[model samples]
Target chain A: MQQLDNTFTALSDVTRRAIVARLADGEQSLSKLAEPFEMSQTAVSKHVRVLSDAGLVIVEKRGRIRHCKLDAAPMKEAIDWLKYYEAFWADKFASLTKHLAKD
Target chain B: MQQLDNTFTALSDVTRRAIVARLADGEQSLSKLAEPFEMSQTAVSKHVRVLSDAGLVIVEKRGRIRHCKLDAAPMKEAIDWLKYYEAFWADKFASLTKHLAKD
Candidate 1:
């Protein structure tokens, strides 16, 4: 899907990937997630924005704090695309196995 | 791995993704791979080059023909990286299930 391109592009950035990693562990406030990185909160928010735009991260506001979490559903598309090759390789390997057995 | 970003980046293009999808069916010569698309063989070659650069596709030249194939090895890193979020969601869902059972 076209959206998968956006998803992959969003994840291409190391900072965005790091944000996803942090969110994967648990829901975190923007401030807390921004703490480990040297960048300003605005810069971190931009990374989060990109991830959110790509549907890889979901952000929610609870009272005064906004928390972010990883949404892995779109990630399935990326993995599914990759997994097709897995099946291809498996099929190739099976044929190879059969060929070897014939020898 | 930094290369994982390139792997994802390469697959972001629709033409490249189509090339990968085609390759997944079986190994194909460059000319054969280019047949379905309206683009020239040179354009197809460029897409293949991007895929090769990302290590997602492998090309072998035998005789006068070059065979192209899908390489799923590097894909494992991308999937493995995503599976970490799978664990996260599994953990979250498990806790929710436990809480529901208690109610």
Candidate 2:
């Protein structure tokens, strides 16, 4: 559950989500990952740091360059949590339908 | 995207997540929702407020009682966003399999 806390907290920002989306294709140098955004590399790096801290992204330093890669396991956990409520919603829908049928 | 931000931020706390989980069974009075936790009703109400701001939970007043209900739409949206990366992880797994095969 703490993992979910970290995962969701790290993902609450738009820029962080975009960074994750970009890294989904393949591993990228921090600079390369920062290129698509208008923000400074430092700004982007901060976002990456949040993602890394949450275990959503992995950062490896190779010489002077830092590379970022997506780690989707935490994301899978988040999805599992959200999916649990699917049954709840499905039941609500079923009940709604039944109630309407009575009318 | 802002909705996603609110949804994720609202869910980042353990107490809030527990509140959400309990509400999944059915609508619960605010006091009833706080009953299982050691926290005061005020503390639980704050958590509920955050969930309400995120549009994850709906609060209604019937007389002096507040009925809290789970709104699964935002949770569904969050799941949709996370599920987009399913393809990325699947591809990564396939590539890992191929690499292992070669070794």
Candidate 3:
């Protein structure tokens, strides 16, 4: 549950979500990651750091270059949490429909 | 995307997520919703305000009671976004496995 909080917090920023979206294609450098955004590399790197801290993305140092990759284990946790409620609500609604049908 | 940001941010807090989980069970008032937490009712209301602002939960007023319901439209959007990346990453891994199999 705490893990879900961190995951959701890290993903709260649009730029961070965009970074995750891009990395879903493949890993890339800080510059490449910042290419689509109007922000500086430093700004983007800060976002990546937040993601790294949350365990959403892993950063590797390849010589002097920083590489970012999607580390989706935390995301899987968030998704699992959300899915529980999704199924819960679905079941609730289904039961309601059944009850209505009888009336 | 802003909606996604708000949704994620709202869901980021453990207390708020807990509130959401409770609401998934059924609609309840501000006090009823605050029953399970160690925090004060004011604290819970503040968290619920954030969730209500995010559009993830709907707050209704009847007489003196404030009712909270899970408004899942935004959660659906967030899930849809995550599902896209989930599919993308799955495809990427599948292609990698295929390539490795050829070797």
Candidate 4:
């Protein structure tokens, strides 16, 4: 439960989502990850910290560089939770479509 | 982006998620929705408000009662965002499986 809370909270920002999207291709040094964002490295680091804390990202330090990697396990958990309601919503949509067709 | 942020933030709490789960069955009175939780109606109301603000729920007034209905469009939007990474993660898992098989 707490992990879900953390996962959702960590992903609640656009910058963090973009960071996650970038890291999906491959691991990146912290500086490289910060390059596309308009914010300072400090700001990007803060966003990365949230993702790391949620276990959605893995950060490793090699020499002076911090490498960020996408860890999709927590995200899988989040997807699993959402999938529970997938059928529910699908049914709702189906019924709404049927209702609309009649009107 | 803001809607995604709001949806994720709204679902960050267990109570809010539980409320969402309940609403999945059908529309529910705010008081009835608060029944299972140990917290006061006000606390549950705040959670519902967050869900409502995120467009994940629809609250309708019927006389003096507030009926909460799950508006799963926002959740669907969230799932769509998360689905963008589904293939990426699946590839990772496949690689992991292949590596483990080699070991």
Best by DockQ: 2
lDDT by residue for model 3 (B1-103), tens: 7889999999999889888877766778999999989999999999999999998889999999999988766787888777776653356776466447434
Worst 10 residues of 4 chain B by lDDT: B94-103
How would you class the docking of model 4? Answer: acceptable
Candidate with top TM-score is 4
Which of 3 and 4 is ahead in DockQ? 4
In what order do the candidates fall by TM-score, top score first? 4, 2, 3, 1
DockQ, cand. 4: 0.46
TM-score of chain B of 1: 0.79
Task: Output the number of the lDDT-best candidate.
Answer: 4
Please compute DockQ, using alpha carbons, for every candidate against the native two-chain complex.
0.44, 0.47, 0.43, 0.46
lDDT by residue (tens digit), candidate 1, A13-95: 78899889878678899999999999999999999998888988778889989888777767767776776566544576764
The ten-residue window of minimal lDDT in model 2 chain B covers B94-103
* lDDT of each candidate versus the true structure: 0.81, 0.86, 0.81, 0.86
TM-scores of all models? Answer: 0.79, 0.86, 0.84, 0.87
- With a 3 Å backbone cut-off (N, CA, C), the pairs that clash in candidate 4 are none
Residue pairs whose backbone atoms clash in candidate 1: none
Q: Write model 3 residue lDDT over A1-103, tens digit each, in one string.
A: 6777788999899889889989988999988899889988899999999999997787888999898887665676777777765653456677356435544
Candidate 3 chain B has its poorest 10 consecutive residues by lDDT at B94-103
Which of candidates 3 and 4 reaches a greater lDDT?
A: 4
RMSD of 2: 4.2
